[model samples]
Target chain A: MNAMTDRIAGVLVLPQPYVLFLGDTTVPGFAKTAFGLRDWAADKCVGELRLPGATVTTGLEALTAAEAHARGARALVIGVANLGGVIPANWRASLVEALEAGLDLIAGMHMRLADIPELAEAAHRLGRQLIDVRVPPPQIPVGTGRKRSGKRLLTVGTDCALGKKYTALALARAFERRGIDSDFRASGQTGIMIAGGGIAMDAVVSDFEAGAAELLSPDAAPGHWDIIEGQGALTHPAYAAVSLGLLHGSQPDVFVVCHEPGRTEMLGTAGYKLTSVEEIVELTLLLGRRTNPAIRCGGFAFNTSALGEAAATELMARESARLGLPVADPVRGGPAFDVLVDSCLA
Target chain B: MNAMTDRIAGVLVLPQPYVLFLGDTTVPGFAKTAFGLRDWAADKCVGELRLPGATVTTGLEALTAAEAHARGARALVIGVANLGGVIPANWRASLVEALEAGLDLIAGMHMRLADIPELAEAAHRLGRQLIDVRVPPPQIPVGTGRKRSGKRLLTVGTDCALGKKYTALALARAFERRGIDSDFRASGQTGIMIAGGGIAMDAVVSDFEAGAAELLSPDAAPGHWDIIEGQGALTHPAYAAVSLGLLHGSQPDVFVVCHEPGRTEMLGTAGYKLTSVEEIVELTLLLGRRTNPAIRCGGFAFNTSALGEAAATELMARESARLGLPVADPVRGGPAFDVLVDSCLA
Candidate 1:
């Protein structure tokens, strides 16, 4: 995909410029993963097919399968990797209808759509492809654990779906302006599509997770470093392992811990409380030093989406004091990148 | 291997028992992994061949290749997965000589000896076997993200090799006396050999790390719980990822924090200071809750090897007070397991 309109770009909106989200992504928890996938490309979403009793964002209309087809939608993407992320029968019926309507299916849940024979058969008969973003690359390397000269900065997080990718992307963009020389090493599908040069780390077999990290951190150009996108939190229950491999394999010189300012509970866990910024910074160090003692906590980047500008600023100020490191909202114009590059790459 | 005369059983007293450690494992940093492996089997070691001036534990003699052979050495194990854990040429020569000596070779480093054609050829010509403890199981599943019952109590640590396995083992043994019903789920070679079942978490492909955790946490048998040996620290420079996967995959109901008393600096990281007990515990919760929100820090277990008994005791008391959790060394009798069970399982 071209850099201008990456995969998330298309996923956010379909080729026919009309899309239907199979599941209502309006729930606070279930919508975290898939809802964020296309928020940047919201215009393509014509409406969502709600599974009654679910509320979603107001951007899309609630449409039935017939209504979605009558409206000219091209694909049916599972918009929520819900509480267990399994494609259940209720959802299956909707997916089956979508497939029979000849709509392509795109999903990023732990469960693959093709795993269900009925869905695979329906998609096959319908002449539409089922895309599983978590699929690993055809080839992956065994990690050499060799150290390199170029600096690597990875964005870790307090929990899953907490803007790690956004922080890394912001760093990449900031680096571009500063001419500090860097590459955004994508660790997920949204990233891979955006950067056009990364592997979906989760799809890779566990043994090669670190290897994928290693491969992603290319030998530096004469004046370049790699700003690798961090995956799940090292503490994330569902995806910590994936994040761990990225941390070790990347061997980053410094890491930035991403946090959601108003997120008191971890996304997937039933209701685990969030820890303070100071503690997270230290905990991250405990994990980072395993591979590289020189690794440092560059700073913190808050996902300030839930807060007003002033409130986010106040929270960040408190966090900065707590961790004694640079902190900012990487999403908006801020100092996180400056602090990240200066302190880390300095 | 027989439980009574396991591999470690022989390494502790090997000249009469016969042993040959291929590389120098005397340095404080490089020795942690290998030294721990056979320190329990020291009497079996004839001598560890050195790279001229490379010192080893006082227990093992620094013997020449022929001297070790004359001493009836039967196996050639790479004593150290030294700096970067790579197989360097300096150590390769000794491996070749050991093969010619008709000794079996065992390695636990990131580098597999079998990957080296010349080394494999030498072993083949010598009729000696090559054993890689870290080799992952043949097949690992992508996690179902399903929640499980039967208390999964995983041991996490401030750093690697700080006694996570020891803690798990201690819990297992303690549970045995109390008839509490539990399995010592091994995650590393030492734990594997000790428990007689487990996959080397690191050896498996990255995607399967969590899968390994799932498999290790077998369908709970009736009322029995699973006390899984944890691997690598969440903040380890090189190994946080491995630890992350183990934490997420195990889906423990409660976790015990492992620490190395008086270890101001992390093992491999140059000059990187360790974090506080409170931070590690909190960080672990952040990761654990992603899978199980109720995942609590059961207690703290200290590796106390670097400090005097009294100093270690003082350290534990202070840490316990600071974190409001019971703390003790798992090796010697203490309240860690009790605190662990009461706080977590209750």
Candidate 2:
């Protein structure tokens, strides 16, 4: 067990009843945090606060920061997952308004909210916390890679922010439905907020990346399952270190490769094509063998949100036949997902 | 080019002409920092300071911190590289005494020297700097992994604290001797002290690991070579993420596999066996191709300090023949090392 787990876990105690803040974002993809909170923790979300030009919504009731605070919202959660996790200059007014209205500011951006002058001054004067979940806890030990007793599964991807988190969440829910013991081990900001506890693997120092992952899912019961949420793709140019470290430290006995069809280029990278599912599976097994020799590919999960039901079903079946493994969109849970769960457990 | 390079290069201005402090370390391996500085930056070093039980020496003139300060040394460099980079409790008195004697303290340990209460108080009172080289610079951009123009040679090891840094230093010097435009890019503390300026790759945030490496060796003339000092090994359970990130980011055209023959277990890892040079070669090529498809293994370097001259020679020749590559000890610079350097440039 990680010695710092208890102390580190205590550091991220966010106030409940949040008003999801959507900045000047138009794309629905950028509002994943709001959508995720609404989907997984709807009861905790009082409403959503959107800027003047914002076009995307999490379908919750809209409210201003003052209105949300009046309605008992204790914090304003920045719900946009932008390209660089940067808070725009235009968002300062809304953030300051929240602090003035007796609410804390919560963010998962790369840049801390406390670093922004207006926000920092407002929060300090208001005596409200400026919580940045992406800040890793200190003194995370280096990974030992010693095998621990557990039945583990991980959701890996061909790129960033595709469907790895959703797949793991769905798998863990299915395991619970079957009366199987399991936990959804989150590794990112959204998933951490949803799970209410997880280490921000990317925020840790490079020397302790794997150690942070190992601490995320410690030893469990022999039959218990840790459906670990993955980070970057192993083929990703910028973030593969986090991916590889999580893989080796999690030591998953089985893995599900997540992909998004029709996506050509990697996120935030040019001239780099999306890696093939076959390549992902091969590489996962090859590299994962360093820590877990019995690692196996459970199946594939395709984010077919752009495709109709018939087209998505046809593509999944065709790929399943080619790979000789179960394949399904975990979001569209059905008999196929059931088969995937069985194969993963088998 | 990196915009922050110039600013970061100015952060580590160590007042040189220093005293190297060995803090109760007996094993020569644990005193790598002292030896590395003595071997690479002898002109900057004035004398050595040892605690009562310290049995190791860098073969420099022994002088107390006060004596060294009187003789024009400006700082006391913590020259021990123990297993965790920790400062022993018994050595705190010596460190405080150095500050009393008007010497700044420079350390590459995981913990900052300024974080120690006594040292911090003394340094504050004395107005002396406590420079911690392991602290990474802020806002390192994510690696793009676009192939930059310039040849690179990285030295990869089978375990930690072996010959990776030494081999890179030797290769860079050899390149300069051959009238080649080259630079030795430091990635660790001792190397940073020797080279005067370089990134501490292991200290950066996990998300920016590759980015740090990319910034460490930026674009240069087509004929210029960047001999990068490698970090942890790819097969290492605790630190493979750092190794893999450096490999992908540097995009080394040629890499030299370094090993310490006759070692049974990995450093600091009890059950983990040492990785073979063959395994490292295969893994480096397979993973390194993600960034540089033309990546090649140039040769092998063995730390033959534990063996007799005849035994070392016989083993080098046999291994060279078996692997179909040049093999030599860079420290024992001879005709074999010359051949190794020739093959690396080929």
Candidate 3:
């Protein structure tokens, strides 16, 4: 295709199943994912839609048929499954058909596979291109032993408007007042900083590529604690997807998901509840386990005025314990919320 | 016009301006009376160009012309002037022309006798329509023999995002803790709240209309103690215009204009520096004298983190005495700043 035609056709990697496992539920994560893709496509001026897939035994066949329908698809993103295995036999024909139709498959594998000869052979037979998303095992540096330095905690929140960023910053400030060298990672803030570079194709493409590379590489140097900030209402799924990409890339020691108050009760106009602190935390923990198990995980930190620090702490503690992780309070106490930050990192 | 066509052509009056004011030396006060007329035939989008003479002068000619131009305008907004009187001749003509062009002029001042006569005459002449922006002024009851009881203090910040809302909220909290009854009125926050309602209009239009109605009406009650936050980074002229309107409308007992830390320093993106805080203060004091001679005004509240409590207090006292108003500290104690809400209010 010519340059203009290629631009119009727009090569997109549609993740298989159209939705990945978010915690234990098979909810409509597409709207959220699609929103993120839309945000990425903003400057490109491209349109995108997620293919539908069933949850039952016919799910694989259904996904393949959907892929077949996307005949002119230039790229295919094979979403990583929790369990590692070969492609199902029933769906093999559809996969070959997709390749014959000139689809470049990008297989994202969360598992630490020693080899993928079978998959490679299948792709070769179909005359398709493949890019393996196989992340290596995380390891601490030689000198940096796994010695607990009194739980050097790193807290992260969403954005200032959403109250998560402030909550995290307040927690960090509280820790500082208490003589704790806690690192507060405002990933949302960093994302805003990066995005503020302006909505341009090259910028976004570089950001995505860099984000992907960062996700695959595990760096032992102390992670820079940053908050994530944005203008739009927190319901946009793009926020959640970006959060996922950042969390995966940064490999934060402990993730502290911050959320707005009363967000859990509201029917998010974005057709999903990525703003729900509990839901996001659950998904983060699940993704962490599947993508990088070495990264230790924490729990949610909700706004104090919304959830009340005590209730929020207890509820989060219960939830974290259920997930076999450390418990932390989202908000600090007066002077500021002091107990919450101290306990979370401790 | 058909329903869809009418909907497309319908003028939407946004009730607030989400403005980021940048710069220091440009204007001494807020801009309340600026008019914006977009040429849909050219770019089909509202360009950021303020109408000349509309803000500075006033008369029927300027008003008429503005109205005539607005007749074919997809949207028309009349920013209420705070200081200036009598619309300029050229501006009158422009306004009338807009009305004749079949534009829906949305304004808050349509109820005023001076404004109403022209509006009705223009509507009759143009055979067009008009929509008055109706936002009821805040009501605080007063009885016979009722006099101002408690001290009325107003907090004016340097600009937006300079921690104005934070300072205001902290001050309120501090006063509450000190058993002092304090009420807050922030034009900045109010503007944002009104805009968040999804009123389809531009920032300048909404803000100007809301500001004019809020500021000028005698029926409007100023909060017991108001914290009028200014827009930060005064790059846009609209911020100054809005600030001026707020200042003129909500005549306060004592005005505390917050100044940045340094007289000559670059902070924030716009690189704004208050070259002559004293000169600006003098100008404001002069304007205050013109409006209300008895009104007392406070000098600049320079944000300092290095000064000791005694030094800061002394500085405040000296500045307040110089400006003929009480000295109030936004951050109490020297450099180790603690938001001393109670002590400051007290």
Best by lDDT: 2
B1-346 per-residue lDDT for model 2 (tens digits):
2211244442234577779999888999888788889999898899999988889999999999889999988889898878776887899999999999988888998778988999999989988888787876776889888889899999999999889999999999899999999998999888987876678888888788888888888889999999999999998878988998899889999999999999867876537889899999999998899889999999999999999999999999999999999999998879999999999988
Docking quality category of candidate 2 according to DockQ thresholds: medium
Q: Give the number of the best model, judged by DockQ.
A: 2
Note the clash tally of each candidate: 48, 0, 91
Prediction 2: B-chain TM-score: 0.86
Per-residue accuracy of model 3 over B151-200 as CA lDDT, tens digit each = 44444555433445444544555556556555444334223222211111
- Give the distance in Å from residue A52's predicted Cα in candidate 3 to where it truly belongs: 61
The order of the candidates by lDDT, greatest first, is 2, 1, 3
TM-scores of the models, in the given order? 0.52, 0.87, 0.25
Worst 10 residues of 1 chain B by lDDT: B6-15
Between 2 and 3, whose TM-score is larger? 2
**Cα lDDT for residue A145, model 3?**
15
List fnat per candidate, in order.
Answer: 0.42, 0.65, 0.00
Candidate 1 chain A worst ten-residue window by lDDT: A3-12
| Model 3 alpha-carbon drift over 4 Å, by segment | A1-346, B1-152, B157-163, B174-181, B189-223, B232-238, B263-272, B289-293, B306-328, B333-346
lDDT of each: 0.69, 0.87, 0.36
Per-residue CA lDDT of model 3 for A1-346, tens digit only, reads 1211111212211223221111121343422322332332233211232233523121222234234435333544333233343443443454454556555444334322224555467668866555333221122111111121222233334332454444545555555666654443323212211121111111122113213223222233343233222122212222222333334334344555555545543222223333444444554454333223444434445554657556866665665567554344433444223434544555
